[model samples]
Target: MTVAANGVLPRPSRRRPPVTWGNPLTYGLALAVAAVSIAPVVYVIVGGFRTTPQIVADPAGLPDPWVFDNYARVLTQSDFWGQAFNSAVIALGTTLGVVVLGVCAAFVLARYTFRGREALYTFFTLGLLFPAGAAILPLYLMLRDLNLINSYYAVMLPQIAFALPLTIVILRPFLAAIPRELEDAAAIDGTGRLGFLWLIVLPLSRPALVTVGILAFVASWNAFLLPLLVLGDVSLHTLPLGVQNFSSQYTSDTAGILAFTSLAMLPALLFFTFAEKQIVGGLQGAVKG
Candidate 1:
């Protein structure tokens, strides 16, 4: 055994780059982005605490003598609550309508390969491209014809219609991810199409549904132009319209406006806080599927 002289193979050494704080570029960039994003929220919150005079005197300074009266006023105002209620109703109604219709449409498009399927999908998607502004005049006329102007339905219906396309788009991919074998098995068991969809598809689609619901809620909540044109009645005004009214009524009352702004934003904030994870997960699932 003429073995070679005992020679050991050299092991490759692993090295990691050392971290250093002296390279503050990344930290500085992150700080800049954070400040840019958070500044408006801080301003609005601070403005809510200060009186109009204080805000005007020092636009960026902290409130010297904090006042809770603005919040109190917003809470106590009858219009505030009434408008908030109207907004809630409209947003909830729109979300429900869009999700129901969108899911049904998505199921059809995803599961059934029928004639004109692509055309139907395209037709529904076309709504997404249609600007709310473009349809305002026609919507106004239609609402007038139906005598729904200034009613919650005027705002609610259009919001549902406007949101439906995006909802369908979001849900179609999720629905497509579901195994066809499941539906076939249900069919073999004599389950009707609607039964399978209602029982199996809907349950499996909770994440996507929640994601769409949140999106619809946000869209309906933040809507301005549609409600502005349709909801002429101050009593029926949604939050966006209500905020506009608040601003107009109290243009000089900076604190009051900020208070109302903060209040108006609470629902959206709470909604995102609760459903944000679901929304992200659902989106990821849809993409992966």
Candidate 2:
């Protein structure tokens, strides 16, 4: 330790090291994987600007003279907008349901002490292993019997249920990390349990909630099989179902199909992109806790 003229030792520096990209091979592999995942999406968006002849001549070539006709036509279609609205409704509904239910359940599991609490949490953890595909048959039958087969609830309800486990899993740790002193302080300040949760817990857990909400929204937006099984009506179709129907209807119109697909997926991609940081922060907090 260095001593100053006054004979006091200097304070140690706490600055972090300068960051650098480590492991060239790892970065190369990551870039390769990202390229592979992104190539098809890029192709679809770029293909929307090319004519059918250009695509047929050079399957992987860029647009020579970019044209906006494909996208323009898609925008002009009433079906596209209608399907988009349906998708927005379902995604938003699913996000709201998942966040509300997941938060309530996670708060209970994290804060309360009771018999079978761990068991209940474990039961929810087990739900993670159950995929929607396995239960689609019975789900469809149940929805059908309930006369909800053609309704938005048919998709939103099951999606919320399937999303609950992960949502709670991510949120429980975040909520539990709230120091007990804060709860006591809130109690002394005339805050009840629900009021504490509302006034303090929710604000503190915003990142985790946003993470789960975006996940649920994106999942619901991209869902196909459930909507396909339940939403047979053309008027009720979500974007995925709309994409399939559009592709089928325009089998030979490759450019138009590509445009339609690009448009359909753009919203979810944009939404996720914008909220990427919250997702990472929430997951990091969960891991830290």
Candidate 3:
């Protein structure tokens, strides 16, 4: 047997594992799901250029006589620009507020446990149970009492408050995972709490920050009810409110509605397109933390 083994090649030692996509059915199903999800977005963008009649006749097909007038008209509208600017302001302000307050609060709660810490955190976490729409009545009353109606603060303040709970939830786990030894070393080397936060904790927390910041920005940009309730001035309308108003103003114009909606959604789409990888990558790192 030993001599025979030497004379002939040995039998194969092992078999390779099957390739992941070797199953046609599995890949086919994945492609179907992707197509289903992407179809509506594609239709919206394409349908924006179609006339009302064309859209009605062939809702899923390309425009025969493509109309650029609808988008061009919207582009020239001052109200569109005003609302878009308002949306940018609200998104930026709310994200900044949530980041600064959430980071500082999450750092303290995660690093140094004190009396009522659990209670406070639980209280904030409870905010997640109820959405902004659920608390509309009281929110309106509080804002009215503060004379903040029809103001940017009316929108931004509530958004900041509502965003905090989620920000804390995202940030606390990551911050708590930070090594205490590094903070202690910083303290020995003349770093105060603020200094340790700025020089150490914040730098290490880029992933969590990016994740929460994007979330807050997106949520604020897409907010509807709060802005609708608080903002009576047409000039102060955000993008969502603008879309609603635009649709109402052009009630008979389906093409205009589709075009406005497509335009309104473009900022969010472009932002996600670029930052999709960042959000995914950061989330992977943050989950480990």
Q: What is the lDDT of residue 145 in candidate 3?
A: 97
State every prediction's TM-score relative to the real structure.
0.86, 0.87, 0.87
- Kindly report which residue pairs in candidate 3 clash with one another: none
- Model 1 — which ten-residue stretch has the worst lDDT? 1-10
Best by TM-score: 2
Ranking of all predicted structures according to TM-score, beginning with the best and ending with the worst: 2, 3, 1
Model 1, span 1-289: residue lDDT tens: 1323333223346354344443355566678889999789878977898888988888888888999989889999637888888888988999899899899999999998899999999999898799888889988999999999988889888888888887888888889889989999999999998999998999999988988888788878888998888888777888888888899988898889999998888877887888889778766754664
| Of 1 and 3, the candidate ranking higher by TM-score | 3
Per-residue accuracy of model 3 over 154-219 as CA lDDT, tens digit each: 999999999898789878888988998998999999999889999999989897798899988988
After aligning candidate 1 to the native by TM-score, how far in Å is the CA of 86 from where it should be?
1.0
Clashes of each: 0, 0, 0
Regions of candidate 1 where Cα sits further than 4 Å from its true position: 1-24, 281-289
Please, what is the whole-model Cα lDDT of each candidate in the order they appear?
A: 0.84, 0.89, 0.86
Instruction: Report the C-alpha lDDT of model 2 over 179-228, residue by residue, as the tens digit.
Output: 99999999999999999999999999887889889878878888999999
Ranking according to lDDT, highest score first: 2, 3, 1
Worst 10 residues of 3 by lDDT: 1-10
